[model samples]
Target: MQIPEFSKEQSALLARFLAEQKDALSLAQTHGYLFAVICAPEPLDVHQWLEQVVPGCDGQMDEQVLFAFMALYQQISEHVFETGYSLPVSLQFNSAQQPYLDMQECQHWSQGFMLGAQGYIAKLLAAPQLASELKEALETAQQSLCFFILDSADIASIANQHGLTEGLLCQQQYEVMNEFAAGFAELIEAVAVNSQLYNDEGWG
Candidate 1:
């Protein structure tokens, strides 16, 4: 069971993410914002963040689970791509691992990694102390997707009151928007294990 290879577009997108990530990782100004937020201590208004991710959601990340996780990654990736250097991503998934991840796996990328890829990102933001302001910004990124669904007023409120959409805040704060990397790593690992199991069982 060979995992499907990267499409040209996806490779391009990955290159873009890597490049931006590299710059962000290096910049004293915009370093590692996405990585931290995703792994921080669960926020009080977790629903607000989740609401911003999944539209028409009156629940938490754990309630609507799959969409929540996918939305978070999609929004973050979209933002990174939307930046002056967008990437060409593909609609490809490792079919062999689908059933495994979709079934055997449960919970968010953080839980899957048994480590907080987002938390690791936060460390990059502060380099010493993970402050409350950074945490607030992290929530903003998490809710970014759901925020798109709302009209300008509501979105503006979050942005105005909490500095949600402020690039300065997002840039200055910590976030783990790169949870996709963590999720993908687990995806490939699961695919490998599944292929082995299938081989052992004499299945394709």
Candidate 2:
């Protein structure tokens, strides 16, 4: 059997993506847990630092959007695992989302993680000024989102332990993330317009 070979660029990007995702997951799961406790506002600081290291981060992506997505994703994750809400939309997939998919426990954590991944991929492929910036953004955003996940999981653990209710926290996060995803949404739209124009000599 042969392992498929990717272009050097693809391999590099994938390697970075995997490494970043690993860091993100670890941070998310353990950051705020009671037994395996995790803490810090450093996660947010880390995001700010990522913006400095990665130029065009704000232009290409929105921090608020990322926050919302993570929040929603974390909620979806808890609900799904605890039999809260199970919609196909909650379990949907795209090429950019696969890396964050976690089945051992919380699926929404993975989903939330991939939400950013999808946006990162779109930016990397489309924005020359932002290529390197995105690399760092992915790394930083992964950390912050993980921390966000950790916090949510901590709350859920308590809720589960004490028999409490989970509310619209995740829905709010999803709305925010969707707003952020709109950045990639626009990028995708631009790519489509450009491709169409080039194909038929209709540049506008």
Candidate 3:
């Protein structure tokens, strides 16, 4: 199914706003951050998550920019809640007439996702109801997403630690990206089910 997205003009404006802020996440990173916030097992207050993206969360930011940013978050949250597996946009480039993933943007997005989801992940790890198999899958998914964020030195260290070659890791990049997305979707479903069961018990 086709997904709704911010228009180029809106994106341009957001980018400008991000550029002006000190230590603020880029547009791509903001998208990833918001996605993680939406999929978190427990809901994070909108103001809380907004502070992560912009840092201040008061009346300092321009009204128009803040409005656009909040609108972007709302759209992404609605999409995830409505259609379970929809991913926010990522960068792609044409190389030799074939499309290739933009690793830099992916790195920023992955970093932002981790930053936003760290609290939820810690809770998930300790939750007794989380099955062993699902926990393992979550680990694999986290590793897959981490690949994009790791530097060459770190990648080499990991490869050597695992007794694997850098060439092998490079060859598996695309496959790992697919795995990351699928695993994230699975995580969302699992957490949603857990939340629902918790709510039902509370009501009962």
Report RMSD (Å) for each prediction in the order shown.
Answer: 19.0, 17.5, 4.4
Off by over 4 Å in 2: 1-128, 131-151, 154-166, 188-204
lDDT of 1 at 19: 42
lDDT of 1 by residue, 1-204 (tens): 232332445434433433443222111111122222332232224444334333344652232233333344444444444432121111233665321121111122223222223433333334333345544544444343122234446545656888466433332221232343334323322332333322333322
Error of 1 at 124 (Å): 32
Question: Mind giving the per-residue lDDT tens digits that candidate 2 earns over 71-124?
Answer: 433443344335333222233355865323223224344343454344434434
At residue 191, candidate 1 shows an lDDT of 35
Candidate 3 residue 107 Cα shift, in angstroms, is 0.6
Q: lDDT of each model, Cα atoms only?
A: 0.33, 0.35, 0.68
TM-score of each: 0.21, 0.23, 0.76
| Candidate 3 ranges beyond 4 A from true positions | 1-5, 83-95, 156-175, 182-186, 189-204
The superposed Cα distance between candidate 2 and the true structure at residue 88, in angstroms, equals: 5.0
**Lowest lDDT 10-mer window, candidate 3?**
195-204
Which residue pairs does candidate 2 place in steric collision?
A: 28-146, 31-38, 68-173
TM-score for predicted model 2 compared with the true structure = 0.23
| lDDT winner | 3
Our model 2 lands, by Cα RMSD against the true structure, at 17.5
